[model samples]
Target: MEASPILIAIDFGTAFSSYCISVNSGHDTSKKTERYETETVILFNENQEFEKFGVEALTAYTKMTSSEASRYYFFQNFKMELYNQKITENLMISTMDSKQLPALKVFSESLRYLKDHALKALSETVAESLVLPQDVTWVLTVPAIWDNAAKDFMRQAAQKAGLIQDILSENLILALEPEAASVWCKQLPTSGFIEEQAGILDKSTVQQQAGVQYVVVDCGGGTVDITVHEVLDDGSLKELQKASGGGWGGFSVDSKFTAFLRQIFGPVLWEIYKNEHPAELQKMMHTFSIQKCTEKEDIYIECPHNLAKLAAKNKDISSYFSQLEGACWTDGNIKISYEKLASFFTESIKNILEKIKEILDTPEISIDFILLVGGYASSSLLREAVKREFGSRYKILCPYESQLAVAKGAVIFGTDSKIIHSRVSALTYGINMSRKYDPLLHDPKKRRVNKAGDYTYCTGLFLNLVSKGQSVEHDEDAQYTFFPVDDDQTEAGFRFFSTEKLNAIYIDEPGLKEIGSFVLPMPDIRLGTNREIHLKIKFGLTEIKANAIDTSSGEVQKIKLKFMSE
Candidate 1:
């Protein structure tokens, strides 16, 4: 007898993936509440597909095997794919199928790999109990930036990955990775608020400073994500505004860094980056990975002797790439300095700071604290950039376990039943004004020359409460008002847009599964449409809200999940 597939929470991130499944006591033995996590990478050989799953695949790749793998390796958190305009048809998972396949298909297979591993973990844990495959439930997390169309693509991928059609309901878990990281950092705090600030509040009986508002400037390998978040009243969160970000991460820096390295160290260096990277060559790789350099700087990185052996069997390259460990390029007996590497990474660090400064200058927004997370967030160059701009406006809090913050926060929130809890504030929503566009005009940028007032077809645009990271108590009323464009039509389309920045879920390093999206209708509304579009966005559980303005119009649009009339 085997235990049923259990309920699990997977924090499938952009750089790394993790699954935290609940483990209870066995049948006939008390159910114990324990949990475990696994890194989300799937490496496999063409013939040894069965041998590849979870951490096992990572180790097996280094071993000698008669069967050729075609070197198929998949890593989730390849979130950088969302913005790349060049990736249209075949993804990195192209070798699997003979023809050019939809990127979505390859992405789904990546997710399938992770889910399959999670199911295996659960199966092994509860082997004594009776379990069924259908018993397992899964919840996945996505970045809070993608729109509905992308998310719709993700839903289809999930279905192909074996989710029953009946259970296939898409819910957007709009977590700002940086904010999520901040929440995780706050939970593991070493020092309280600054001493003088803390004393002033206590001695004067003033309001307690809620906590730190860490601005997470996540400089990832491929993209740079900047997020600002504050702790909520209920030990949760409140995103000050929409997460401001751009395509600036570690990978972006790496490209430029590689170019700079090639300029200085010559082209022979790139051959070492191909195929597998050995321990000794890894030092050189890091040097090449740096973005730029400063005056009077020297590039000397220390590497092991084993790189020569690695280079011999893996990548066929210049003499510098002597196979010492894997496919790593190394000196016969020379040394490399990390000191030079740091100096070379400054250019990338400079760009990241400029982006953050622009975010700070946005209307009605100023980040108080700086949070450092993600792979590149640990870079000393990035930290200095943050320090220069912030200048003690708030202290920078870097968690030792910064990389794992998102996975941990997601898992914690997942296991929390009360976390999804919400309140219903209003019984029904009604537009107070009817077709009133006879209002203010003359912000020429927004309104036409001869219009009653500035009216947008997007009733969804008139949000009254909650921008992004704010955690609300369940059943709270989400209300907003809309002024008609021209008073031309009575009916209005109430489309609901996702409150996220990027709603993409990646499957592996070369493939991306669009499992998350925001559902909104692009309504062709007219002028003078003065009507309050009232709807409710509850605290817990994410859902869709589409609208068809006039049932007679037959025009379907993305609406709030809650009923418009009920």
Candidate 2:
């Protein structure tokens, strides 16, 4: 209890959440809420009230109409919303900010509380302890499907919390979620588990638990992320592709379940459900109502068969639960059976597994086992559905703290990268576009450039040499040399290329696919208009710097691509 720890793995998940400290325990013992942890988020409010978190937060917000509890419950895998501008709000709007707090802020506040709790726990345990760990590093897990902006937002929230709370001496950062699952699962297998197929843990254990070549349909609170990984040549593991990111997650699933309940029971005894949960009825309609994608399934509030039956003018909501199990699932009102839930999941698993099959068409990219990690991976419905789609040819792996696996694995990665710079690598090239000059501008020369003249045709990636899943990274400068394609036009009038739609080429059957691609700057060029173009790429932490020069003429210019900094 004397030495304080420097790093902690934080799995801030969708449904349930947990964290693991670097310190390991021996034999059969308690991991106490202190050493290793999970929490039902009953947050302490400014007024010293123990507010809701976890499943409690869920039920509370579901019945709420006020924005406070409703807004705090952004269950969209809040971590992933950081990068994108457009978002769908199925949940009611509420937040500390009267104007509406961004999802990330609410998420941060939750973590801030967790940090405070951790600090208090540490202090309490060590009555008069000396020699505590000097550094404090956070290894935070996020959904693998999250984009840069989502990740950026998480980093920002972490920084704000770290600064505002003054809770740590230093903060080293490591981020990854599903990838961490692969690593931790490989490490925490049972003794009898086979090693040859271990992702990071044991091969046999995976087979006993998950299934082979199986796709892990991790339906969590915010988003469902599917990862397909292959066993490496040395029997290690390598991620092949991110199969899917969906709106279908635990909260969504529960919401659907809730609606289905009311549909069947709305005419029966609603008192039981209401008594068990006083605000249950309101919770369903206002905050966390059951939602459906089916065109046929129209959900109506639970009401007694007659207003006078309950000796009241309004419907007796208590009658709802009596018929909760009577839902007509074919109409999508509720999940009628385990089979039905499994089938619902089966379709989604098939959709993503089909994509994985396409990507791994090459035997070189084949995966042997599917790894399952996340709160909802514990679902009996999802587990069997995954087994059905991707059967026994490959094994499936699941970890104890399945939801927290990513964060823990992130910590392990952080440990490695903290010692070696090359250990932590990323793909970086400014997102750019192609432009057209006065002349020699092919494609859409006469196309009207908009008022911004910051036309889609004028800005695109400078160099996109790094593709997803590519491991070509170093602390070294991102340098790429591009001689004009034609090389003989007037100072190749350089125009970057960007369009409402990205141009991409295909790669099936010896053809090209235009998944997405943009033109680099439209270079205004002539035989000797410019001898050479010198480009320097600089990225320090969260900043990007690009310096371009006409070496022949000694003209230098720097491009600030960022319209507004994060």
Candidate 3:
């Protein structure tokens, strides 16, 4: 391997995962392989230790007998559990069998498996030299809509996996999944994308031109993350609006399919079968998953032998399915009508299209292109839905191998972090503080008196640092000055709050939420109330960073906000 730094990007998606390796600036093409991604599935032994990952795990579990499989744990689609939820260091996640295990253990062990696999691949590619952990820069992809707590949880998981020694090490970078996709899409010409308009002659990177704007709709397996970007004058990218999305993704369609099966098999029998024959259920879903992504025509899924045996106890299996709509039983396979199959994607496609319209509806924001990326973007059903709704107004483009875009672009972002110049603030951030009570502006009920009874202060005041919808650059920071309310106070606590409101007034407002907090030590009380503490908060990156300096002792304290614990 070359002495130059090597970059490895890991796209840990909900349904599937993939990684890419690059030496210096280009890919390390020492070996040729057709597979670009694998199932995000893991299997653990009876002792709760990691056994297999990805395809191997799926295969091992599928081969095991029902009795033998019950002793072990199989987990898939576990990544989505961290989204839109309160995360803690000791959070526990349940396996498909409803077995409990630490979330940290599951995530860290999975990451460790990927790390070792990548290193092994690199070693075989270059026998002349060995690659060390320090020689490679790691990039992890995460959804842009994830909160600070979720992002922090991923960093801690990476550290626990031995990817880096320190939590704040520069060697590990968290690349927003949509942003990574944007970076890779910008380097391609119009012809590189799928379903381009007819007779388009300009072949250069049309979206790369200065002032060109586009919307990145990352329809992953778990969630769809949408963001608007514009090319800066210098060719870098800038976010036009904050990322907005929902739980609408490819998995939603899968859920509908599961429901449809339940309808055919009767809810009581289906529930009982799910509890008794989980392995068979998993196998059936796995088959449906592959067919849903492809197969535009009628789809046939083989019914598990156990499920068929159980259904026969009540009545003829063929007679049972005949009563169902758009389903037929023939040759031991259940055939699904194409119209009924397309209906599975109705909710996801509707939500995605509506979100894109909402973002483009912003005043002064004219989008020239719409880019679809991620694993779900490969679905022919979703492609047609997006094109039908906005194809006439904007150039809808999906790059070749759209699923690999995030992983490959993450490698490029790891090499150069300045490709994204700015980002839009998703929420208003501020610190909860108390100031001198103002009779005119402060509510009398909120007024408080100190122990000394000499000063009157108002509690629950929200000191705004950054407002929602504000454009912030990576280097730009919001600074504020604070002082102790009591002359003899030896420490101060900083509480961080966020809300969707553009300008919040109080910390206890209806929509505001206290995310994390940390206490800063003020060992020196000699300066009394005159001591000045400077707090600086930096945003626009994958995670928020905060630090404070005490002018009296010239001490700098790095802040890692603590979230709610279990």
Give the per-residue Cα lDDT of candidate 2 at 287.
Answer: 30
Best by lDDT: 3
Ranked by lDDT from best down, the candidates are 3, 2, 1
The residue pairs in collision within model 3 are none
Over 341-458, each residue of candidate 2 has an lDDT whose tens digit, in order, gives 3334444455545654554465645465566677666654555555576555655555565665666566565454321122111232333334343344433433345444443333
TM-score of 1: 0.58
lDDT of 3 by residue, 446-560 (tens): 9998766788999889988888999999778899999888888878888999888887778888999888887778889897889999999988776788899988878799887
Q: By how many angstroms RMSD does model 1 differ from the true structure?
A: 11.1
Ranked candidates (TM-score, high to low): 3, 2, 1
Could you tell me how far off, in angstroms, the CA of residue 263 lies in candidate 2 after the best superposition?
3.5
Runs off by more than 4 Å, candidate 3: 1-4, 25-36, 126-130, 198-203, 444-456
If scored against the real structure, what TM-score would every candidate get?
0.58, 0.59, 0.93
Give per-candidate clash totals.
75, 70, 0
On TM-score, the leading prediction is 3
Model 3 lDDT on a 0 to 1 scale: 0.85
Model 3 residue 214 CA deviation (Å) reads 0.7
lDDT of 1 at 391: 57
Query: lDDT tens digits, residues 155-203, model 1?
Result: 5556666643432333223343554455445555344222223322222
